[model samples]
Target: MSQPDSVTFADIEVAAKRLAGIAHHTPVITSRTINQHTGSQVFFKCKNFQRTGSFKFRGAYNALAQLRLEQQQTGAIAYSSGNHAQAVALAGQLLNIPTTIVMPEDAPTVKQAATRGYGAEVILYNRSETNREELAQTLAQQRNLTIIPPYDHPHIIAAQGTAAKELIKEVGELDLLLVCCGGGGLLSGSAIASQTLSPKCKVIGVEPERADDATRSFHSKILYSVNNPDTIADGARTPSLGKITFPLVLDYVDNMVTVSEEAIIRTMFFLWQRLKIVVEPTGVLAAAALLEGVVKAPQAKIGVVISGGNVDLKGLGHKIMNYEL
Candidate 1:
């Protein structure tokens, strides 16, 4: 099937309307310590507090909500590492649709359990030995399930934009907006919204240094792929940007940068210790960039997206205890 045209700002607006009362308009947080550290006034769109503890719920719910009656009755299928799996599962449960998620065997146990708890069937595969998308597609065909892609679909992209839409709406204009990039859904979607809502704000995409496909793609002007990256930021281990998201990122995003795994870990600890908020490593990507001085604009009003908080506490504790600096 042909991909839909790039998601437009108008599409995001419609998605915001559709998601109203369903997705949480998560709070925007600020920290004097963060402001002092970065020398910039910063606002954090804390989607960690969102239902399912991630912004993925916005896209998942919007996509599931728009499904036709026949599709809804038949059910939906998706592939994810963790966050999207839980998001799809919970959205399906809320909408009374059966959901099946294909995830890596190494995905966080807490996330897997949460997905199953939401009444979705779980299929696990070895990340190195199997292709998740192919498996999900085969299952979707066999089960007559509509594929609710994590980030590649226009509806998903539009839905993901609602986070930025809500942020800009609540915080007013910003000089810059930083988003964590996985498959580019959130980054591309937020870029679109930022362009429309806060046109003067430069939208930047941040990624783990190990999983820098989006950053490479942004600068190289060509799509880049990676084998699974060995990074603690599991959500950003995507191979590459999708065709739908690539162009959107190229057109609307102002810049892309990467931060070290150490920086990600440090920022996660900082947010937990200073702000009293739990942010997973992936959720701290944008903040990592700013705090590490990978991307800086002193004295400017900046917005950063804290993407999720569905961390495996035990695993996080182990990392924290073992990690140095």
Candidate 2:
């Protein structure tokens, strides 16, 4: 198992301190009905309530905060499907550094608008024809900006580690930790923090069936890609495992699982109606995995991190009404 470079418990402890007032100490929420149905006590880390409405803010802000003075003045750029784009935009706005986001032209309009609303310049490219990495590279050369990747950097991972560290602090000794995976930043960081802080807790990553690259990669012991996903969980439509994140997940993650789009939509509806929480399809998929029996809930106390709440409401009703896997 290839682990992250010599990250000790003390490293995550330091990250928690640095991230103390910066990242929101999102609450651990529970529902009696969910607990009764699953036959397991559950603690939900509601990162949906985090700044920029996702856990990405924790890592993005942390990475930006650690940058050298020159790097801060030179500004930063990122390529994301949605949540990370908003994270970087908001981080840059607070740090007073210029930020540019290169995103798929077909990203959720709400997320794109939110990124722009933060005053970051938004660049859109065709998903099919233009490679975002190549475009970001070219832009970096021309504009001299640091490209803060969505999930593949250590500083970013350390920032993400703060969420799980806080969760363990609030609800001690969970038996299992579940997190939704797009490019694996949240899961990787959670794994590192969980292994170090709550060593006995088994960490699992959840994904939509249509965008199950992490699951495939874990099973094959090789990095995998699922470019051009057709899932409703648009936030998780990344094509592959990130370079830094892949090894971390392979080493520390206990397992990776998938849920159908139908299950995801059903869980989204349940969360909205029953939990009164507005979770995006990607965020709801971990609960959906449990609901669909893709994940056995016999592991005593299980913690699921609800990632983000950036769903598009305009066509949601129609999709949830007649959606299929």
Cα error of candidate 1 at position 42, Å:
0.4
- Highest TM-score scorer: 1
Runs in model 2 lying further than 4 Å from the true structure: 1-8
**In candidate 2, what are the lDDT values of residues 246-321, reduced to their tens digit?**
8888888999999888889888888888889989998887788776778886748988889989987985666666
What C-alpha lDDT does candidate 2 achieve relative to the native structure? 0.86
Question: For model 2, where is the 10-residue window of minimal lDDT?
Answer: 1-10
Candidate 1 colliding pairs? none
lDDT of 1 at 214: 91
Please state the error at residue 87 of candidate 1 in Å.
0.9
What C-alpha lDDT, on a 0 to 100 scale, does residue 292 get in candidate 2?
Answer: 71
Prediction 2 TM-score vs. true? 0.95
How many clashes in each candidate?
Answer: 0, 0
Backbone steric clashes in candidate 1, count: 0
For 1-325, candidate 1 gives per-residue lDDT tens digits of 1245778889999998988888888999999988998899999999999999999999999999999999999999999988999999999999999999999998989999999999999999999999888999899999999999889888899999989999999989999999999999999999989988999999999999999999999999999999999899999999999999998999999999999989999999889999899889999999999999999899999999999998998877776676688
